[model samples]
Target: MKAKVFIMIMLFVLFLVGCDSEEEVDRKVQDHIMETYGFEVDITYRESLNEGNMGDRIYQVQRKDDPKVEFTVDLMGMWETKIAGDNYEIQEEAFFIGEKFVKKYENELSKLKISNVVFRKSSGLYIETSYNSTISNFKEETLQPLMEFINLLNSYKESEKFEDNYAELDINYSNDKSVQLTQIHEIKTLGQLKEQLYQDLDISNESLKAKDEELFIELENDLRKLGYQYEYGLNSDDPRFESFGCFQEFYENGECNEGYRMYLKGDSLEKDKIFELIQFLNSHSSLIFQDVIISNSKDERIIFEDIKLIKSMADIDTVYSGVNESLGKTILN
Candidate 1:
């Protein structure tokens, strides 16, 4: 009887040991699988419109490996804004009447709108102004000299005034390629000269003299071709203008914000569009900062200087469902 009892105790100890070993093996396998195919996601949730209570949670997904994957929960109807323009590269003192005088002169003398544009691409100073003619405007003779200047600037890490002759566009193409030569200039005045004399004066059609109008039309057609809704804005605050690449929108708070929105055809910018935009905003709240960074990586950072990240939450599932039902779904698939 004593020998049988001892044997039974030994058997019980073996069973427990086997069970523990199995558990350990299972845990390790699970951990390895999780490490292999899993993704670490940081999700931030906002609690209220004004209460501003927000929280972030880290989640492990089974199959995402891209380190740069971003998921946005857009709440407000904010879409990306398309900005097009040129950069100014002239000296404040180089102009006969100084920088202010040059600017005023350009605004008064020139037909195309010359706002504060800077087009320095590893070069001294080149501007991208919308020419009166649209023939994919670069050539070898016109751009070569400017590119050489730009190369010099990159190498020196300094800004030096090229000779008045240095500002000339000497485009030369060894191969068959369209190079925009006329649009580049070392100074605003020189660029204006190139645009007016070679670019504008060369155009035979008198009707095409108006570049700003032509550009607006081109923008309209391009947006339409891209399947975006388009319309002219009579009222300054109309959101429809946003769809046409206008970023200025005034709010009730007496502050100005820059953003754009586009909608499907037959959709109202105020009703269905607003809700859709709101959903996009909510989903992409975190992306706002990143978008700014990417869009203006070469310039000054976009400071939402006065804007506050207020908290807000509606039922996300409900908002998403409503968007799908109303928008009829996007063509991303």
Candidate 2:
């Protein structure tokens, strides 16, 4: 009778365990995600630590349908490492979505794109979150931190006016919402600062405060800011001159994809005097001169290159000269 009682108790415990199995919930959630979101993603967790580092919980993911999609998110959670840096220890819970999981939506998922979100986090926050179809609908403000970082990196990467070396911080909030009242820390290198100057120029060149007294002065300032320097052309007396070198070796979206050329002309003792002439011509719409021919002749006859190219002015000059030679004869008319 005691043996029978023990068997019955063991069967009851097994039945209770079966009822709470997460496998059922996982299957249902996966089905709902595929049907509703039109995408497939696989989720996995990882824990890693080197000798000098604290253990980190990394959530890795892949798009089952798309091989090109993959991303990971690391949770520091009270883990601190002075060698690796200590700026990212969250007292609150934190949640990070791996890049692979986010990539499944690609063009179909508007909110999942790097341009759509911004990620910023503070310490001492508790993090608990899961990805679902709802993630594709995150608002612009909610994704500002991540989006801002992505843009910052992207713009820096592509800007020829800036440097390539930059720091990155990927963060997410566990609370499922962005709160303004939080402390977030960020670190960047001096190279990034220089690159930023280049990008800032693309944003608004009017803000650039360099002496345009010489092209070399502006180019040197831009390159020095980007942790770089350059040499000028060997032919100093040539007809054309390269104005500047790229400050940074990168280029970003809406960047200067094409090369721009500015021409210089006029005989002046000072460079500013030449610049004033160019500025005056630019202010006038009627004046369009590509080349200036300094007439060393004593006649002081100004022959515009365009007038010579079209030859109509040449023909007119010939007709006028012939008329002058004829001296108002009725036969010439």
lDDT of each: 0.30, 0.32
Per-residue C-alpha lDDT of model 2 across residues 204-256, encoded as one tens digit per residue: 12111122225434544543443323222312333233332122222243132
What TM-score does candidate 2 reach? 0.20
How far is 294's C-alpha from truth in model 1 (Å)?
27
Q: How much is 222 displaced in model 2, in angstroms? A: 52
> For model 1, what is the alpha-carbon lDDT of residue 80?
17
Which candidate leads the pack in lDDT? Answer: 2
By summed lDDT, which 10 consecutive residues of candidate 1 come out lowest? 288-297
Q: Which stretches of candidate 2 lie over 4 Å from their true place?
A: 1-17, 20-23, 46-61, 67-333
